[model samples]
Target chain A: MKNPFKFKKEIVNADLFNNDLPLPHSEEYPDEEVIFSVKDFQFYYDNGEKHALKDINLEIFKKKVTAFIGPSGCGKSTLLRCFNRMNDLIDGNKKEGEILYKGTPIDTLNTIQLRSKVGMVFQQPNPFPMSIYNNITYGPKCQGLRNKKSLDKIVYDSLNDVGLYEEVKDQISHSGTSLSGGQQQRLCIARCIAMSPDIILMDEPTSALDPIATLKIEELIRKLKEKYTIIIVTHNMQQAARISDYTAFFML
Target chain B: MEKKNKKINLSYLIERNIKNRKYKDGITNGSTFLFSLLCVVILFLVIGYVLFTGANYLTPGFITSNYSQSSVALRTPKDFVYNENDYDFSDLERFDDTYYSEKWGIGLQYGKDNNQNQVIYLVQMSENSPFHELVRRDDGTNFNIPSDMYLSYITVQTELGTYKTAFSEDGIENMISTLDEAVSIYDSNFLTLGGGISTSLITTCYLILFTLIFSLPLGIGGAIYLGYYAKDNRITRIIRSLVDMSSGIPSIIFGLVGATIFIPFVGSMTGTTGGNIFTGALTMTLILLPTIVKTVEESIKTIPKSMISASLALGASNTETIFKIVLPNSIDGILNAAILGIGRTIGESAALVFALGTFITAAPSFTSGNTTLAVHIWYILAGEYPAYEQACAISIIIFCVVVVLSLSTKLINYLFRRKRER
Candidate 1:
């Protein structure tokens, strides 16, 4: 499918592409703790019939926000999915070289354990066809958290963290899909947070949303950096400059 | 001036072309619509005719009563004779005996014989008597009384008077001495004459119940395996094609299979010699599996891949995801398959006749031979005297049941869709 945000790359002078936005510079985080390091990473599709990403090396610092920015078909989202082994679901996909999480090779860790600690939000807000309350508690419940009071607290805190608690408190029992696109994205973020993961991956999470919802998500990411490591893929350069402390550019 | 003229010509040409296309489209569309409407009309007419004809015979007694009635016949003695002076003739009203030449009537009268002992005389009354007329009018014919039979009384009635004339005491004694025994016979009621379908109905219910019980789990399990776990390889592809092909195979073939395989298997288990409801249900299960599996697989496919991914991402196992997410979403399809299966079971006759037997028993046992509603209709129609009225009534009942099943299926689907939307 052709990327819907392809025009954003051509519009260099657009507000979202501004270089003068007030943002935390990466220089201040030079000595921060490194959580993940990629060494000579390579990714392939269809059993190496097609090369998707090549010669990638990068580091994600602890409790810091990192962003990958590029045009469509540049493998930004593909590389982000590699962190949580989401690429394992696709048939005929292969990866070479090493990825380390806290100085341990990621291959040694169980995929389920890796995923629970490294949650992901997709480009579209693909919430399960269930109530908002269940959506938030799904991850926690899967982790064997069954106490009702604890679940309630987790739901309130997660929704509160994404600033959606007040807007949806009256109708929390409503389907998560019934919310607007912005609220749905926030719900997805809240759902990711409820797992209490150490790292959260966002794959163009705001591409399907309006500018207002995008700004809200960027602000949430800025606040979330204090508690969790965040990595986001975006085609909008200014979003990366505004919310991320470190930015890596990919070229097809 | 020339440009303006050309513009007007162009506009006129476009308008003519548009009108011409619309006229052609209308003809094709109208013809197809009329043909479809005609088809629907014909279907309704057939159903209406069945209901109209069968409504006359669909009485409550027809459903509840047994097949035959018990009756007996008694014969009188030949030695008894009538005496004119034995009974009073004062109240007698006489009629011409022109209507009495061949008809004879029997009447019972209590009197004393020659020995002065009380006896009941079986009298052969004359054709001109009131008892003969009463019997003829009620029974639609005259009694065939034998010659030389004795009489104890002759009852005659007229507008002027009523009289009871008796025979001699000696004739009554001889009649009582020579009379023979009474013999019993059973006459079939309306149901035995091909009016009732209670047995067939019960058999159909049994077949549907057991078929579903056997097929649902197997069908759904196979569907889950195919939809979620099976690899998209040559073997799986061949299996899928085989399932599809089996569905298209004539059900009569399945009937043969059931007779050859299921009947013997079930017969051994239940210890019966011939086909029964259990064997028929097993045959139906084989016929229904393809439909159930295909529909459920399709519905499972419709569940978004993202849901599975989301569940897996939440650290849930593959089995957990399948049971909790995939099966729940495919419930509508499962129910739809069951409805279709029921419709097939009810309308099935050729297969069941071979597998379940064609005998309609009043109380069908699981291990005993029986006929379903469809087979019952077939039996009635194929008999020496075709009972179309009762056959049509059974058809009406089957039609109603199928219609109700489909309507309920639609209602459930609609409610599920509405809930999902909410």
Candidate 2:
């Protein structure tokens, strides 16, 4: 909800809900449609005892790869999670900022709807303990897609897009975790793609893979760039330079 | 591998290492082995003794038969002969401890009555007498007469004279030989016979079933609240502590609570006066809730946190995630809770003594009070003539049941893990 009223005296944890507070543009970017704009954002952990991120400002261009490369504990992953409100699941989490998704305040959007449009892949390859086909269809089924044909198409297209269909075509019904580490990583990406999200968030997605797996996922990301806007946070400078179109550096 | 091993001089290093710590290693190793062996020996010894003593008595009838019997006075057949010389006790049932006389056509099967009094038990009458009617179970070859009847007196006729002998006299056996020659054949006293664990076993089974019926939902519900939803706060911590503490409380306390609260509550609905199987079950539900909640919560905790995140990220609601993932995954824990309930309920006697009375009924009904297998042990052993053999036999049954439940729990868990892994 966009709140109009604001208290002169700030109440702890309640100040961020004063949604009508305006933010001035501080940085210049190309005239492309800004898919996501972070304005003076601050993130805190341990009930505001530790300031994980402070005064962060950035603008993401449509259908382009934007990488956040920073030292450990600089809250790169925290900011990525904030885009889909994944941080809300954490206990004692507090944030003060304005984040807009396609010019609309992200807080105003339904979380499930917003997350359906903004998919995420974690650092480690964490596929569900289920068949590969079921893993891809899980998101669509959650969105109430009951038709078998549509789900099968989604599964086939998603796996095809991630370059995993050929390798796992014969064993698509095998347990997702039973695949090799890199194959599992690609499978996770395929799972995210099945939801038909507009933007894909990768938080050090290849950190747990070998060199060969890293190269494969990087190539997949470049091909996927034509369809989905990609925002990745990685500590590997070489990975950012090789795969990302624009990069932002952060320091503790 | 051979070249690497040749360079290391493995034998020399091994000899040096062993010599330095040989004394310390030997003492510790010997003590550990001896202690473990001693523990295992003690365990097997106890079990073996129980099995050995109980094996001789563990018959199918002993388990399935009823424990209580009623005695009755029966009359001789209209064509019964008074010939003592034609006495035949070949078909008479035999027991090792009791004495039977073929000439008298009578037997003292189990010497002691319910009152623990040593008395002469009447077994058989004439070949066609109405006093000793037999009805076979499964087969028509054997018969069990209702027993425990007392004989006030008996009139016997011999060559010397006809004399009246009271049952308590020392010369009662001398008079029993002439019992068939008595003036009135219909003046004999009859006895009731019964002793088995079937009723108590049935009661325990009913107790486990009904208690689970009432407890699983509540226990699992509490577990969900504690495992999935509750935050780490003062209130939640207190609630968790209370649940843990409740499991440690003696079941006897729960029995008292049942007697005061649930007994009246159940009695109001049932229209009975005091505690019965239903009330006992209600009390057991209370005793088992904490155990079930803890086991269920622990199982729920075993689920990886990532699965929950994955489910939520897929746009599944919290309730959906819980029902689809957490509950299904935690089934092993739920079954374990039921097994724990059974083992505890079967072995529970102190609490049942209050919730369910010490009375052993032949045909156990939910409306009236009856003892379970455990309470049955307490009943017989608490008496003057303690039936240790029967108690051990009952223990063997309970032990086997517990072992079977434990093995089944393991098998079920293995199957679940296998299915999940596959």
Model 1: how far residue B50 lies from native, Å: 1.6
TM-score against truth, every candidate: 0.74, 0.77
What i-RMS does every model get? Answer: 1.4, 1.6
- Residue range A1-252, candidate 1, lDDT tens digits: 224246322111222123233332234365766777888999999878889999998888878889999889989988998898878777677889989776666776676677877889888888888899999998888777899999999999999999999999999998998999999999999999998888999999999999999989999999999888999998888888999988989988
Q: Model 1: per-residue lDDT, tens digit, B88-175? A: 4334333442111111223444433222334343334544432322222223343443322223333322223333233334454333
The DockQ value obtained for model 2 is 0.35
Q: What share of the true interface contacts does each candidate keep?
A: 0.49, 0.33
TM-score of chain B of 2: 0.73
Highest TM-score model number: 2
Return the clash pairs for model 1, or none.
B80-B150
How much DockQ does model 1 earn?
Answer: 0.40
Each model's DockQ? Answer: 0.40, 0.35
